[model samples]
Target: MASEFISSDIVSILLFMSPGFLTIALVGKLYGIAIEMEQFEKTVWSLIASIPIGIMFVYLNEINSIDSFLNCFLVHPLRSTFEIIVFSLILALLVSLIIQHKYLENLSMKLIHNKDDGFQTDRTVWDRFMQKNIGKAAIVETHNSVYKGWLSANSSRKEKREIVLDSPVIVYVHENGNTEDFPYGKQIILFGEDIKSITILEED
Candidate 1:
C-alpha cells in the first residue's frame, strides 16, 4: 500500500511540475542565461515557481465557465495541460524580457532610491556597446583587408565573435601608404579571429 502511494505521488509530481521546469528552461534559452542547478534544486525551484502559475490557472478556471467542459475526461487533462503550457510560455517570455532589458529591475532600483541606473547586466562590454550601436557606420580591419560598412549583426558570445556588415567597401592599402576604396555592394561577414580593430564612425 505504501509503495503504491509513493509511486502515485511521484507520478503526480512529475506530471504537475512541468510548468515550473518549462518556465526556467525557456527563460534561460530566451535570455541566454547559464542555469546550473542540481536535480534537488531544480525540483524545489520548480515547485516554488509552479505555485503561482497553478493559482492563476485555478483563478482563471473559476472565473470562466469552462470548468464544466474541463470536467470531461478527454477535455480535462489535455486542455488543462495545454492552457498551463501556454501560460508558462507567456510567463517565461515576460521574465526573459524583464531580465534582458532590465526595465523592471531599473524601475525598482529607482523606486528604492538606489544610485545606479540599473543592475549590472550579465553581458560582455562589447556585447553591450554593440547592441546599442548597431546599424551605425563602422570600419572593421582584418589581417589582410579593411571593411567599411554599416554594422548589421554581432554575435553575443565571448568566443568566436562574428559580425555582419551591410553594403561593405573593401579598403586596399598599397605599399606606398596610399589607400583606395572599392565598393562591395553586398553584405560581408567577418570573424573575430581575423579582426585587428573596429572603429565606429561618429554620427553626422
Candidate 2:
C-alpha cells in the first residue's frame, strides 16, 4: 500500500510540473534567436507571467484523474499534462513572434525616415538613388585625374578612413537650401550651419 501511494505521489508531481517546465523550454528556444540579454530577460519574465495558466492545467488534470486506479487507462494524467504544456508553449511562442516582428518594423521605419531635418532627405530619394546606382563607393583619383581604386561605403571603418580623393572629387559645395543625396563615406564640412546635404557621384 505504501509503494502504491508513493507511485501516485510521483505521478501527481510530474503531472503538475510538466506545464511550467514546458514554458521555460519554449522561452529558452526564443532566447536563442539573438544573444541580447535584455530581450531574453524580458521573454523569461513573460514566461513567468503564464505560470497561473500552468497551475490551472496541473490542478485540472490531477482532479480529473484522482478517483479510480483504472483512470490511468482511460484518462492518463501525464498525457493530459503534456497536452496543456503544448498548448501553453504555442501561445507563448506566438506572443514572442509578434513582439519581435513589431521591433523589426519599427527599426526599418526609423532607417527609412532619416528624420534629420537639416538634410531634408526622405526614403524615396534614397531608394531611387540606390536603385539607379549601386551603394555609395569611394572613388580615389590621383592629382593627374587618373582613376585609382574604388571602395564601398559598406567596407570596414578602418578602410573608410584610409580613403583619399584627388582635387576634382574633393571640391567644397554649398547646401544651397536644397536636399542632397546622403551618400556613405562622403565628408561633409559643416561650417557654422549643421550638415544639410550629401551627394555621391555614380561610379563608372
Candidate 3:
C-alpha cells in the first residue's frame, strides 16, 4: 500500500516540482526557525511530512469526463496538480506554525516573552532560552538587588547553579515598586541560590 501510494501521481507531481516544493523552508527562515544545518533539516522534514497530510484536506476529485480535460490542461509546467500541492502545503504550514510555534511557545511559559523557542535542543528548555538570548537585554532580580543589562552569559543546564551577567545596570525600585535603570557593574556572577527571579528583557 505504501509503495503504491508512493508511486501515485500525487507523489510524482510533488517530487517533480522539487524546485519550489518546500516554500515552507522560506517561511521558517523568515521566522528565524530554519537556521543552521540541523534546524534546516527539521524545518524541511516538518513541511515535507505536512504536505501529504495537507493533501488530505484537498478532497480527492470525482471521476468524470472533465478529468481528461483537466489532465490535458495540467500537462504543462504549471499544472493544476502543482497548484494543489503548493496551496495545500501552505495551509498545512500555517497550521503547523500555529501548533509548533504559538501554541507550544505559550503552553508552559516555556520561552522568553511567550514566543517560539527557536531551533535548539542544546540543553534543557529554559537553558536553551538563555543560550539563544545571549548579548540581548535582560533584567535579573536577586534577593538584594535588581539589574538590567546585556546578557553576556552562555549558561547551560549542565552548569548547574550559576548565571553570569556582564555590563549589568542596576535598576532601583521605589516604594510603589516602579523601577528606574541606574546602569552599573562590570560583571556579576549570580548563584542560583541568590536569584529570586530573572526576566530576559525584550531585544529591540
Local distance difference test scores for all models = 0.79, 0.47, 0.61
**How well does model 1 score by local distance difference test?**
0.79
Candidate 1 vs 2: which has more TM-score = 1
The candidates, ranked best first by lDDT, are: 1, 3, 2
- Model 1 misplaced regions, further than 4 Å: 1-12, 21-49, 56-122, 174-178
Q: Per-residue lDDT of 44-157 in model 3, one digit per residue for the tens? A: 765575555335323443323333324443464365456556664565466467756678566544644444656334447657667678777778888999887777775565
After superposition, the stretches of candidate 2 with alpha carbons farther than 4 Å from their true spots are 34-51, 58-82, 94-204
Q: How do the residues 20-112 of candidate 1 rate in per-residue lDDT, one tens digit apiece?
A: 998889889988887778899888988877877766776776734333323432347777788888988888898888887989767754554
Tens-digit per-residue lDDT, 73-136, candidate 2? 2477577546676776776576567657787567655665666644442345434443343344
Instruction: Report the alpha-carbon TM-score of model 3 versus the true structure.
Output: 0.39
Q: Which whole-number lDDT from 0 to 100 does residue 81 have in model 2?
A: 49
> Model 3: residues >4 Å from true position, as ranges?
1-21, 37-44, 47-49, 52-76, 81-89, 92-101, 108-122, 125-164, 167-204
- Give the winner by TM-score: 1
User: Which model is ahead, 1 or 3, in terms of TM-score?
Assistant: 1
Pairs that collide in candidate 3 are 169-184
| Cα RMSD for candidates in order | 7.9, 12.7, 10.2
